[model samples]
Target chain A: MTIRQLSVFLENKTGYLNEMLAQLAKYNINIIALTVADTSEYGIVRMIVSDPEKALDILREGQFTVRMHDILSLEMDAAPGSLSKILNLFTEADICIEYVYAFSFGSKSIVVFRTNNRDKAIEIINENKLKSIREADLK
Target chain B: MPREKMRALQTERLKELVNRVYNNVSFYRQRMDEAGVKPSDIKTLEDISKLPFTHKQDLRDNYPFGLFAVPMKDIVRVHGSSGTTGKPTTVGYTKNDIDNWSEVVARSFTMAGISSDDIMQVSYGYGLFTGGLGAHYGAEKVGCSVIPISGGNTRRQLQLMADFGSTALACTPSYALHLADAMAEHGYSLSDMKLKAGVFGAEPWTENMRKELERKWGIKAFDIYGLSEIMGPGVSHDCEYHCGLHVHEDHFFPEIVDPETKEPLPDGQEGELVFTTLTKEGIPLLRYNTRDLSTLYREKCECGRTLVRMKKITGRSDDMLIIRGVNLFPSQIEHVLLELGETSAHYMLYVDRKNNLDTLELKVELDESKLTDTIRDLQNLSRKIEHALNSAIGLSVKVTLVEPKTIARSEGKAKRVIDNRNK
Candidate 1:
């Protein structure tokens, strides 16, 4: 399973995010799953995009400081305890999940998460036979 | 017979300098007394070391007329260096002094193979700064048809150079390069110009720059070195060989010495250049420190002049930079920047110390429309500049790419470096 993630370095200013989004719109790059890590000064707008490479190129060419990072995406049943089950397996395997975000597309639930121990998390996924999606898998 | 007569004349001038400095300037008198030496101690040229060394700061401390040996009424002209802060170091010249200054500068023209038949255009700035008037008077003294085109007006400078059949030009090396660029922009060929020789000075320039200017303008580039403190633009000049500048030691006694210790050094050893004005009647100096770092030689020159010669000034003691335990000069940075080709002349160095490490950040202005603000391109240029600076200065510099027209230009002397690293 593949997940698209955008890492944009934002300077502290009003309407900077809006300006960045407008630039993306001009370049015809679409944002799908989106989240923001914010500080008092600026916010890092992270998004799963329809075209990650083109979005990155457009953002960079427009002079927006950006980086691309790999994220783990898991497709689960759109049930109440699906994310909870994944978290319990990570806890039992002694893998610390830094943060997690989830979005639903029809009946399928997609949860993206980061762990301190990526290898341990991958092992737990294999042992528990959990469905894990990579960035290439989405493409 | 000629050598004996020259020695007698030099001795007579040296005795006059000793008496003037001892009687007139109290600083020199005190300094000479402290050294257990009197005016009577100087018998020959070798006795020059017995005198006290004069420094540029001494001129600054005294300000306008404290260093003059003669009365102010006898002083006919006053010129000065363009100092940034406070008052500049003012130099006074009597009528005889002006005549001597003109003679030395005229000799510089003759060394460059410029003759009375040549129409010389003097482009150095005039006024308090001595370059313009100095060169103009010198060209006139040499019987050359002089065009006192005192700097700027690049269009008019070019027009006069062409129209007046200007066979020679005198300006700073940078201005000469600027004129060449302007000529190219106006679709004029330098090859078609009657210009044969160029006497470039008032700033230290490298031999590479000489070659570049010569190749561009098809003229012989002569290095004329001088300062207002030392009577301007004819202290020393390059001959046809262009090996080293020959100092008129008969008029001005040249010495190379340790800047800090004040002890004289052997020939070929790079040290601070010091001069004692022998024949200067108004403001004769007793071993005035020039601060310019260069070596000296008393060997017979191929140009048939027995005067002492000095190497091209590599750098100034005041401008020596210690960056990350490495010493650097602005000329080194200029060489690198000129080699890069795409960067503008505007550059500002931001030096800061953090975590006990000295950091040098060179903010280079990009040429207009040369490179966009794309992250990749900026990073690439930064890397390229960093590598070049590291190789040139022997220290890694954080290259900050700035837009054009950010850095300020100096009207008189260009401030090439901003040094913030202090002990």
Candidate 2:
């Protein structure tokens, strides 16, 4: 139902993002999926990387404000209505999705998101028999 | 008193002060004995150099009551300045010492042209700190309708100024500005109040600040200089002429000594300011090095006071930073950081004046040991440091966490303070 994600604080300066990415690239830690929440003062780079534990150590060693958190990733069919169906479960359950990002691997689509309700969302997903993603599966 | 008569009186008092301290205070006794100088040696004002110079560390070394020239039974009150560590460097005052303090403050008010008809609002903080009670007693002695309303509570300050017609306001120059801003914010202009004179001190402020304060309140701003170690905020004050502050030479004798060599400099030469309490009975310090840098002018002031005038203090010989009237040291900040064991020794202090208020921003390096993966942890660490610093220095410090190597380093000496204040 969930995989580890790395969130990093970045100053809103030019080439700062590149500097963070370069640190990861130097350590051979590949970023799988990423999204950035930005404000005028700073940015939070929320990312799922190839080796999250190793990537956490590397990014922190490079002096980045990095944190690790659990985020839910749902596997779905590669269709136009796939995300709409998965999101409708949360909307019907009155669970608010904080943020969402997606990518496709062959015929299967994956939607990774954070939500306000974690336990209830997990129960709904398990009861509905929705295919859940794990950290091992990502690795 | 004329210059010659004042020096003669000073010489007489100097001999008595040396005898008092050498016979009463063991600390001063040992220092004088070690220097091989006897009380008889201080027969004239020129012989003050024969006595050993008292450093701030001497006060700390004596701690609570070791430096007092009189017994605890004779001491009436105590005041102190916060030290780098938990212990405060304390000073005690006898009943007569308090009277002298009041007299000096009264004289200071008189110098500023404040009279018994005026209403005075004393805004300096009370408690063990000397500013509040110091000015309060002086204003009371001057027969001014005294408002002992200590620092803060700006709306009430302005309200009292309007309702009670406070003619004189006394506080740090910065707080006076803050009060002015607060008055404006509360829709009360200068015309609404009856502030005629402002006695500003406890912190070093520039002439521009004096001009701004005068302009803001439409009052004549006067600079009053004093430290808790030397009797509080009435040692010297500027007259209506707005020249250098006139020292009350009859009680506290002022001298300029080279900061490095510790040799007496000429009257006009800029050097460290030193004072010898000619009349203090409780803690009679003989030639105490104040660490303040200023010049002394023996020339006759146009206002006709023959008392020696000292220029406004330019800087400190030490690294003590006065923020909002609270004395702080960089080593104190480092001690807090070390005690927390959360930050690297490398840190920098950024001091700036924001909206006429002093702001102390501390930038500490986050080391690997204290580094955490959560923003909450970092925030908590910074807050912890802020709380520690606030408790240690009695001043609110803004703590900022920077990368370990972000603060600039130098080979000669790592810079610790960046004071961006206009002064």
Candidate 3:
């Protein structure tokens, strides 16, 4: 129902992201799905990795501002209006989508997002009979 | 006060003050004993040079109540200035001390022609800083309609000025300019209020500032000077003549000394201003070095007062920077960073005047061992440092988290303070 994500704070400077990714690569950590939320000052590098606990320790030891959080990932048919259909359920339920990103594999797409009401969003997925992905599934 | 009479009174008070501190405060007693001087040594006003000068560090070393001349029960009020570290430079006042403080303040208000009929709006901040309550007490003594509206809340300051028709304002010179700008931005005109005169102090301002403030509000702006250690804002004030500020020599004696040599400079020679609290009961100081740079004048002023006059403070001999009326030292900022425990002490302070308001921005180097990838965490870290500094110094500083090792490391004594306010 949820996947572990690593969020790192990076200043909006040249090669800052490359520096962080290089550090993760040093530990042989594999980045599964990644996205960046940024402002003029800095950027938040959010990623789902194969080994989150090891990645967290490595980044923390390197003196990086990093944290881990659980976000929901839904597997949907890789088709037109697939994201819109899933989003409509949340909009009708009055549950806010804080942020959303997607990655595709085979004939299906995995949509990752954090919501204002996590418990309610989970309940909506269950009632609507949606396929929810987990950390093991992403790996 | 006439010249001869003023000198006689100062000599008498100086004798008493020396006797009090020498007998009560061991810090002062030890200092005097080391200088091979005694209470009887201060016979004339000139004998003050024979005594050792107390530096700001002396107050820090004495800490909270070590330098107080009287018992804690006798102290009626306490005020403090920001120090370089955790402890503040504390000053106490007895009942008689408060009365003398009110007298000098009332006299200062009188110098600017602010009287009983005028509605005085005291915009200086209140609480431990001393500016707010100092002006409030003086305005009450003058029998004026005292507003007591402390600093900030610009909209309310303008509202009360218009509705209450305040004729006099007492605040920092920069704050006065800020208020004028706010008034215009809020669609206010001078005709809407009855503000006529302003008494500005607590920060070093220039003659050009006096002219600018006078033109902005169409009011006569008078400079008032004092420090919390020497009884707040009533120690000296410029008379209507505006030649120089007339030191309330009857209470606080003023002197000029070469900053490096510590030798007393002659009258009209620019040097560090020093003071001797002649009548203070709570914490009587013996030739305290103020560290402020200025000249002294003993000539009879055109306004007919014979009190010794001190020229406008040109600058300070130390690295202390006054931002928005709050005395700030770069060492204080460094102390905050070190206290934060996560950030390095390596930092730089950029001080600038934005729209006539003093703005301080602190650039802190992010520790390589504490890099967090989330901007939220970084924002929280910066806010934490900002809150700590604000509580410590009483000034809101904008904290900018810079790249690791981005702040250049110097060979010896890092040039931390980059003040652009003068430019």
Candidate 4:
């Protein structure tokens, strides 16, 4: 299972985020979940949008430098220790998570991650019988 | 000499200078020949306008000593400055050339009221740069007991200023302020030192710097203008009037001309400053376009020197910054930032190459009062800055917003450009 996440390069400027959002908004795109990674000079905004391909097109057409990255997205029980328990498998496999973001909906929580070794992470995910989502499941 | 007589003297000197260069320096000879002119043609001062303009590139092309108008044995001393790339610009001075240099600088010191009784400490860096020894010989000629205190070692400078009872200072204006700072930390004030007047040169300084140095040291601050190519420091010096630099036009003739058209501009019309060395024996230059933008005033000063005075140089045509193939001056960017408000004049241009393409990153500070709790506001401010810079420079640049006082402060010539591409 894979999730197409969009990464956009952004200058650390005021209203830049709003401008990015506004550009997506014009095309009626919905941002499912997003997080920004930043240094002093510039920042990169990563997003899991309803339509990743459409969002990429809209942002790129607006002159925003965008990159499409396939990340591992999983569904977990909305319970305490759920993330830690799932993460222990990766710890055992010695796979490192580059970055991660999560959102909870009712009793189900969705976690998206970029890792150093996707194959190892995926193998661990399959061995644990972890329920992952493909691009169509988001719709 | 009177102004009219000075013009005649300059005309005669110009003719002699042209002939010397045509006969000795092959570079100038070729340029002169290409212009379809000979040494005999430069009969008057006006004939200088007909000569081909010399650029910094020409100097770089010639490299070490291709422009020397005298034999190598006649050259007693050599001075050079590093170019941006490749070879450095070298200047030669014969024994007579050194003497004349000393004479002009001595005249400059006397004009600044420094006498043999005063302990003149020269603090400009010695070595290849003309700042140090230029003031040294001049002050020594003026009978001032020169301290020969070359640049750096701040504490020692202050200590020597106190220990030696140095009565006059010669260095860049910024170093003077730095010394003022050093003195404050030593539990001493301006009155403790015997510094009466400071002859600041070797770099461009503003009138505000003069006022600040004057106020801090309780001494008069005078501007000295000279370039290594034109016989080092003492080409001109501002008298007590502080109006403009009174150029030693007799030895090295001065001209202001349109940089684009290369046509000589009338006095008071600001343009590129050009020079022709009349008395330089080792490396006589013919119409060396300094590219320093300034205006010339022919009126005699109240101090009674008949030498023409050039207005303080504002900027350089060659200091033209080209980032991402777009041409702009740093002052233009500064103007845009100041106009936007919520920022200090402080900013650093960090130019680098990303993906083999040139990228400019402007690191600027946000005004202290404008610091906001919302990240959105800061982002918006940066966007506004990026937009304005793009509009002004006609090229998009990455704007990095830094906190107040984030950018390092400079005491001397502010280090504005940090080119990271080379490394």
Candidate 5:
């Protein structure tokens, strides 16, 4: 299961996002999951696509100013204490997490996170026996 | 003196320069050795063909004191580029070199019909760049009262021009236009000002631009040409006739050569203009390539200066864009933009390679009052701009309508193009 993610550098304008989406439509690349991380000068439009390679090539070819990143995916129970329990495990292991976002794919609750020490976090995840999904598994 | 006597004198100076550089600077000696030419071999001015040509990159590669023929203690002043992107090209001057530069600038001012009683307002920026200080020293040498305005503060510029009764102005042509716009906004009539003439340079401008400035400000606009590498903005100046800019070839030798072939071109044939500073002491250059595209004229001027004259620079070799085997220049776009009355001069050109196709997108700012929020108006403007740019540049451009004041305004050199073709 491959999760295609887009990291776009977007300068602020009235219809900049609309233009980007229109270009994507022209390439027939579908966005599965999308979020915008923004500052004053520009915004990064991150998206998981149905076809990662095709989307990346299309965006790069069009000079739309985009990047691709591999993010770890963890499925949590859709219960009250699920997120807290998973985060507490990382804190116990002294893994520094930078940012995290959550989204739903069908009935499953998936959490994507970035960490300061990726290798160490991976070791911690293996030690605690937490179920970690690779980008391909997310597909 | 006869032309034959002048040629002999130049040859003698050339031999002296070659011998001095060969004996003093190791770089020149090594380049001479690599070229298999010796200083003793240079017997005539035409023997310059045997010597190697120096380039701007040579100065940059050597950096601070690599090319200086004199000791650091003997050097009096140092000027340089802003070094915004890379290491600045540093130029050193002895006291005598400073005197020579001032004298040449004074001659330029005199050629423009500025008198000793004239008051000059120098608006070119000072510091690292030589334009402001060069003009200031030149004006002083010309026995004129000089105001070193030193760029920006348009309101204060207008105030001083009126208060000090500035008779002549020296600055980049674009800033002169900007000042004209400022005066209009303040409801000040340009005719009421005491200004009589303007000396504009440090960038290439067109005849249409000169005519526009002359009509708007009621002043005779003169073109002055120079580079920091060759003693700043006093190398040459236009006379009242405006036929060509006269070069002070006694100190600086001018040549035009085919950029691709490196072969010398005849007079009136357009090519890259090259200069060799014959009199510079600190950092004398032999056959320094200026990269500016222009032609040379040896004809006598009505002003009585017998020095060689250079045609107004049409474009630069490096600035030429080879897109789809068609050469284009930003000035070509400028010609079209000037014709479009509804569009502001401020614009941004985006060039990118998509699907192996070169795409040109022009973002032009439209004056809001002149534009109606209608599709037909936008379409018409776009089509007109497209047609004009295509006709002028011989390349199709996609015109994008942007709001007023959308593009950035630069106080120094404007950033006109954003090239994304490389990725």
Candidate 6:
């Protein structure tokens, strides 16, 4: 139903993002999904991983402005219309979508979105009986 | 200057100055009559507020001799400001006015504890700027061997200080820093010169700068307040205590007034400084608004001067930035940023009107090491900067962390404010 997304502050520079990924790789922390929010000067990396708490501590030790934000994670049908069907519920409710990123989970696809009203979006997911992912389910 | 007598003499002189301006200068006369303020309305020093407020534009409208209260034959010397904007605001000094000017400057020098035995160097610009001449006359009156080396010619400025054993220096605070640095480059140490005291003015300077000069030369740094319109360079001088500058109230009556309302603010309140030339004979102003923002202290300083003292000028009303109804100065932001010590002193304020709302953006350079390969590091650092600046200025400012050397460095009087909103 929900997973904590770690948002990392990074300057928009080459080899810097690779350096961070190398750090995560050294810790053997597997990633679930990652997306970047960028401006001309800097960029923000939002990631969902196998272990968020451990990743947060590791990044905090690395001296980063790391914080956790609850994001709606759903395992929808792999069919094409299935994606639009889940998004249509949020569109009807006028819930603003900040950004959405997805990754595959075997036969099912894992999709998460950042929205203005996450609780309401979650409510819509439950009322419609859409399959939702949980934190433990990621492990 | 006793306390009771100071008030009595001010009351007496205020009445005379009001009449002189109202009768002799048409600009003052019309403005006074329009405000329904008569010369008789002023009976006390506090009653001086009833008179009309004068602005720089008022002088511009009148141009040259329009504001002079005395006749041309009586005007012995004319010193005009370099009109950077429009016509240069011209000020006249009669034979009596020059004497009074020199007398007040001499008193200011004495207040700064400068003695006749001290060798004084007047480095302030001599020509149109009154700093060099005003300081020269006062130091001369004090019987000190005056070094009339005007501004510029830094090599010679340093050469003279070393050769003549210049004991006191009078120049802009920034120029003083340049001279101090130049002395080192010229292979002259502080031991080589005999600079005992410095009276820095013609620009606003901070306590931090004073401490720097004090450490650099091992001398006392004093703030001297003045403007060309009222009197030159010696309008007020700080005593040994350095609590505040003791205004030469007998000659120039100082008043603090709200810049917008033109109403006199009570003592201890910070506002635009207004002055009435108490004994200025050539061109007496009723209440000339200086636009320099500072506070006045009525309490007697530890130096025991009965004259009113004023805080150092921090920012001018014209330099104030009104962002979303919050009043702020770029100096305040620079202060907090420098105090944090993580960033360089270089910064640029970009103010723009976005979406019909005022937006303030402070772009500060981040030391490369502060940002590791971590993503959240810069974001958190920027948030911390935003919080500090918000607390300092009480306005939520958008903070942008740029790479070092991105912001331009200034050689003289750093350009801090960039108002893109007007464009």
**Docking verdict class for candidate 4:** incorrect
Best by lDDT: 3
Please identify model 5 stretches exceeding 4 Å from their true place. A1-139, B320-423
**lDDT by residue (tens digit), candidate 6, A32-122:** 7888877778877889888888888888777555677777889888787988888889999999877788898556699988777878987
DockQ of 4: 0.14
Instruction: Report interface Cα RMSD per prediction.
Output: 9.7, 4.4, 4.0, 12.7, 15.4, 7.4
What's the best-to-worst order under lDDT? 3, 2, 6, 4, 5, 1
Per-residue CA lDDT of candidate 4, range A9-114, in tens? 6667899899999988888998878888776776668888888878877876786666787888999887889899988889888888777889754455899887
How high is the TM-score of chain A in model 3?
0.95
**DockQ values of all predictions:** 0.03, 0.19, 0.23, 0.14, 0.03, 0.06
Q: Which ten residues in a row have the lowest lDDT in candidate 1 chain B?
A: B368-377
Number of the candidate with higher TM-score, 1 or 6: 1
B4-116 in candidate 2: lDDT tens per residue?
A: 88788888888888888888888888988999998888777888888899988888888888899888999999998844466788999999999999999999999888999
Better candidate number, 5 or 6, judged by lDDT? 6
For every model in order, what is the number of clashing pairs? 6, 0, 12, 6, 1, 8
Cα deviation of A40, candidate 3, in Å: 3.0
Off by over 4 Å in 2: A1-9, A23-29, A35-46, A51-136, B82-84
| Chain A TM-score vs. truth, each candidate | 0.89, 0.95, 0.95, 0.95, 0.86, 0.94
Q: What 10-residue stretch in candidate 6 chain B is worst by lDDT?
A: B80-89
Number of the top candidate by TM-score? 2
How are the candidates ranked when ordered by TM-score, highest leading?
A: 2, 3, 4, 5, 1, 6
Give fnat for candidate 3: 0.33
Q: Taking the tens digit of each residue's C-alpha lDDT, what string does model 3 give over A5-32?
A: 8887777889979888999899899887
Candidate 3 local lDDT, B1-423, one digit each (tens)? 668887888889889888888899998888889989999988998899999988888888988888999999999999888444677889999999999999999999999999999999999989998899999999999999999899989999999999999999999999999999899888888899899999999999999999999999999999999998888999999998899999999999998999899999999999999999989999888778889999999989999988889999999988888888877889888888888887888899999999889898998877755654445657788899999999887788999877666688999978999989867
Candidate 4 runs further than 4 Å off: A12-14, A39-42, A72-79, A82-98, A105-107, A115-133, B2-12, B71-77, B82-87, B143-160, B178-188, B258-261, B265-269, B314-423
Q: For candidate 1, list the clashing residue pairs, or say none.
A: A1-A133, A1-A134, A2-A134, A2-A135, A3-A135, B54-B287
What lDDT tens digits, residue by residue, belong to model 1 across residues A50-128? Answer: 7889998998787665777777788887778978888999888788876678876546578987788978877777888
C-alpha positional error of residue B230 in candidate 1 after TM-score superposition, expressed in Å: 1.1
- The candidate that wins on DockQ is 3
